[model samples]
Target chain A: MWTWQHVLTTVFGSIIFPLIIGLAWGKLVEDNKSFGGVLAGFFIVGTVWLLNHGIGLMYEPQMGGNLPGPWSDMALAAFWGLFVADLLEGKKIELEPILSGILGGVLGGLLLFAMV
Target chain B: MNFRRILMGMCTGAFAGFGVFTIWPSSLARWNWLGGWLAAGIIITTGWLVNHYAGGLPNKEGGAWVDMALSIWLSALLGGTVVLDPVNGLIRGAYGIFHGANLGGAFLTIILQLIGATIAGYFLYAARRSDA
Candidate 1:
């Protein structure tokens, strides 16, 4: 049952989050060059979002069928992007990786709680 | 701040992301444990290889490409995690995008995730600093 609600959720989760995160991440990590990172990150995640939607429209599978949960997908994408930024800096910080996920999870959980 | 440190940060982030993806609700039941572990290993290895071979490259975009590679590998890992079949996996994926489509839900999710990353990144960065 794909309703308006579903569409709205999709638009944000798929499109908006990546855009905001890309911008924020770029700004926070890359400073001057975050503009490039933001653009690149947005394009990369946007492509995935489009692909996911396009596939869904083309093949309307069952609910909870093939999708990996949102948490996993976004986390992975962000991790990859951040990884590139970190690598460029040339300083390997061991504890910094999970910090983002944990913080993201807490923030996500709180938001979900508020919504629910 | 240097290339080595940044590479280390990327690797750490990738590993954490892999763990989050693999050892979660799905890990308990529907997901393939062995496959997930194997995939994580491969992603980590690829990160290491990239660092070793491309560490000193003058081009800045190389790092971005590495991030892109991580996304592809993650998509592959996620796609592979579809134990019930591709259609089901995709439908579930749709459900995610569907949720993300909304302003309230999407904004909340993004902000929270980023905040989480920031706090976590700071701590991790600090720990690494102390280690040095």
Candidate 2:
């Protein structure tokens, strides 16, 4: 059964796990702010999870059923972490990045679904 | 926000997405981690080509490329999740599978996709600005 405990676990895990991993990668690897991106990624996922939980509570009981599963959560969190780290280092958004990202995402999604 | 560029981008993205799925089905099935990374490279390259050709965007050397790759990768990852919903629905509907609606999940997914893409865009912008 889905409960508050489950929600709490999902949120906290999303944040803390990435935080620890990012920190470890930074400390042992290169000592960069890449960890911030990692944190951001999980933070986004946690926020989304929390939002889904709230919506579920307010509306239908199974409203959260369509939320991203664990694999997506981890993949997105990791990528976000890298992106945040780049931002902290003063990276700029350009037309190429924006266009490329959208393009990449569409293809990546198709590949993922095909695999599944 | 040029409509022509957006249309071109959509076509490029759709083609790349479908192409990767077709080419690497075996690798994707054998090892997810390696396969995912390989697909990331393909998608990023495709996105870069689209930007360069369709949007007239220029590329820089060094860490800038990494930043571009990362942005594209994450954006694509988020995009994949967003696209999957409609695709899944279509597939299910084709088979006459019925399920209750999860409005909360749908809303959250849209919100998350937007946030995720925005974050990626911000990073890309920052990276490019620094390069300039």
Candidate 3:
């Protein structure tokens, strides 16, 4: 019985974190077409999200929530689209970098709230 | 100078902090000052560690987009784990920020992180280029 919290954490850890990683960290280090960076970003985000949920258990015994599978899917899809756009454009988009992340994080938070 | 890398470390630490407070507001009150400092220290260390180890490699085979993507990805995972709750808590407590307080502020955080990464990357790229 994966609760909503579990789902939110997973989405944050897996999808959101990865997307951010792909965009931010990947931009800094990788130079090989950005795919590895993106993949690594995905992995890192997923791990962080999971770590947060795991940490939650220490404070509360019964964390509750349903995993928003569709939300997670949408998040992933959006990130990939962004990644592809970056790839085709031949550069990382000149976005207000921190602002973009903040927007993404907020959206993620809202999604979590809704799911919960 | 190495200062840029250190700066990046700080920036990443800050973002890590923001992420925690924003995502899990419930945990904010439990942590004290010491707890928060410990957490921030951990994230800074993690950023340094990642930069120290797997950071030298660049997206040489690809375009600028590739390089930036890799850097962001590395930071996100490294930042998320190393920063953890203690660090995140410390950050929020020190800064007096909260989740949903600056609800749509991730973009700002990301910009800071990017600035840090760019500085670090510039030096790293320069060093690597010199080496080759």
Candidate 4:
């Protein structure tokens, strides 16, 4: 709950985890097609939505994932974090970055689901 | 005149908020996370202890302390499930704003809604005053 572990994990998982995933997402489309970041973001959102509702896909600590607390915030932050990161880094907002972020966010969600 | 715009903005915001909420799930509110399950468990335990020690006498509410205890856990289940409340719609939309960098204008949408909602609230209050 409000334990130190929960608070620390919240920062780690919610902010740091998403930032890392978002950074990678930025690179996902830098080299390839420069299209559909919005669409990709939608998919990432969709995957997380599925994970949240899907019976067996939970990231429960008592279960396999051992996530300190509910990690859906991290899942959500993953898709949206890229844009925030780019803005802070002063990176120009272009079609490609958005496209990669969302597309990569989808990948991140799926990857986490598989691992959990 | 201006009222029309206010209504429009409110409608648009509600639409957008609900849209975000449609995707937002209560996974983050996991019953066990952040002591939610613990709260329920403690209440249930307290109920049991009361029943065992104090004879679980019925109260004015027509239910025993133990019966009330049973409700603590049963009702506690709502803490997490309650994410569906309309206010959570705003919460979900706030999360969606994280994508504003890529999509742009996310703030404007929320701002318009804020103004619209304020004006609407005023009218609601006004309606209660017959003299107005």
Candidate 5:
């Protein structure tokens, strides 16, 4: 049911790549602890990617992973970023946002099924 | 911060979580685990939040439904863990680990959800102790 391409893409493309981007973004958020864009992080990751590519509009994310054409899910990476932020800040794991994100994800997924 | 509150919360929520998924209408075609868990999560989490805010919430008054909130919170946590399965969100990281919505999978989901909620509770308390 899965090819080598699928295996490789799912592992590296889906998991590892997002993990790396998440770590970087997490570190950035940790530095700016007062920053309020965690929700927006999940919201506007694509625009950040566009800017990170030296589209010449914004400072690169703490580190870069906006590779063109890679199979990436910005929301997943952002969730990991939130996890890392909590860990780095030594704060309570932000359960509310995570639950909310899951709610959004499942609701969005179901809506797609409905549309079809 | 009675420690038993968390434990009691987990035990009750565990059943609530199991019960919510157990009665899910997967046979209905339109209602699958994703929809089931999403509805459950939304209802549980929202109910918990409302309980908090409604009970003199901004200032932390007496008899504010802490245990009930904990149960609801853990129930939502359980729901969150459920939808990550391959059958639902197809969350790649959870693919092999979570399996799908089968018997063995449901058992595993309960256990993992317990662990997840427990860890969250640990963090919540640890932060509280430090704050105090």
Candidate 6:
């Protein structure tokens, strides 16, 4: 029963707000000029929330249901926040970090689906 | 990509995933915006622990994030497919106890996490390819 309005709100609250905060943090704390933090925050939080919302919709109750709550969202935001800050701090991207993130995400998904 | 790092990444990811699963509330009625905050705490703590214990890797290029993001996205698709498709009956059956969620719905909820872990295994191969 969610219309475009609900979707838009979710996007704004879940994605845009985090992105703005990330951008600000990058600028103020990390002095990052490239806005890499914004992108990272957007990608990680956006993907996780969007996917969680989509899955929750498949069930009977669409609103909360099995979707992730603020706990997970804030966790993701903080992770990206530090990640972007580090990137701004001149931390080089390597296969290890990417692999680590991917592996962690997938495992989290599997555990969530199978157990929680 | 070093093989040792890949192994460590898998272990780290699994540990994080386990932590999320443990802290996440079982009932939908208990779920709210606060759950996101809780999940976030678990992820950050676990991630920090893994990085600290496993030995962080060297930095490469910004493109790595692009590749990682793309891979994570694609892996969600893949995980969704695996969960929803009828061919994965065993997995579906195993996961059926969680709120009686249909395959499609279940796929949506957990796709990102699965993709995150799945893509880590292929980082080495993906790194070698020019297109990646």
TM-score against native, each model: 0.32, 0.36, 0.24, 0.27, 0.27, 0.43
Better-scoring candidate (lDDT), 2 or 6: 2
Residues A1-116 of candidate 2 have per-residue lDDT tens digits of 44555444444433433344334433432443434334332333223333333222112222223433212223333345454555566656455545644555554444444443
Name the better of 3 and 5 by DockQ: 5
Q: How accurate is candidate 2 locally (lDDT)?
A: 0.38
Judged by DockQ cut-offs, is candidate 2 incorrect, acceptable, medium or high? Answer: incorrect
Among the numbered candidates, top TM-score falls to 6
Mark the regions of model 6 whose C-alpha exceeds 4 Å error after superposition.
A17-21, A24-99, A109-116, B26-39, B46-61, B66-132
Better of 1 and 4 by DockQ: 1
Compare the candidates by DockQ and give the number of the best one: 6
How well is each residue in A1-116 modelled by candidate 6, as lDDT tens digits? 54555343433333332344333433432564334333433444333443443233212121234432212222332334334434444556566666766665565455545531
Give per-residue CA lDDT, model 4, range A1-116, as digits (tens).
13444433333333433333333323533543233233223333333333332322222232122212112322233323433333343444443222322332333233222221
Off by over 4 Å in 5: A1-83, A92-116, B23-132
lDDT of 4 by residue, B1-132 (tens): 244433333332222222222223332344323232232223223332332223231221221111221121111111111233334441221211122222122222222222332333333334324433
Please provide, for model 6 over B1-132, each residue's C-alpha lDDT reduced to its tens digit, 9 standing for 90 to 100: 676766666555555444433433321113544444444344434443344323433224553331222222222222221122233332221222233334453342233333322333233223334343
Which model is ahead, 1 or 6, in terms of TM-score? 6
Q: TM-score for chain A of every candidate model? A: 0.40, 0.44, 0.29, 0.36, 0.41, 0.38
Q: For candidate 4, what's the TM-score of chain A, rounded to 2 decimals? A: 0.36
Interface Cα RMSD, each model = 15.6, 9.9, 16.4, 24.1, 14.0, 10.7
Q: How close is candidate 5 to the true structure, as a TM-score?
A: 0.27
* Model 5, docking class: incorrect
What's the CA error at residue B22 for candidate 4, in Å? Answer: 1.5
Clashing pairs in 4: A1-B34, A37-A98, A37-A99
Using Cα atoms, each model's DockQ against the true complex is: 0.06, 0.12, 0.04, 0.02, 0.05, 0.15
Categorize the docking of model 4: incorrect
Question: What value does DockQ give for candidate 1?
Answer: 0.06
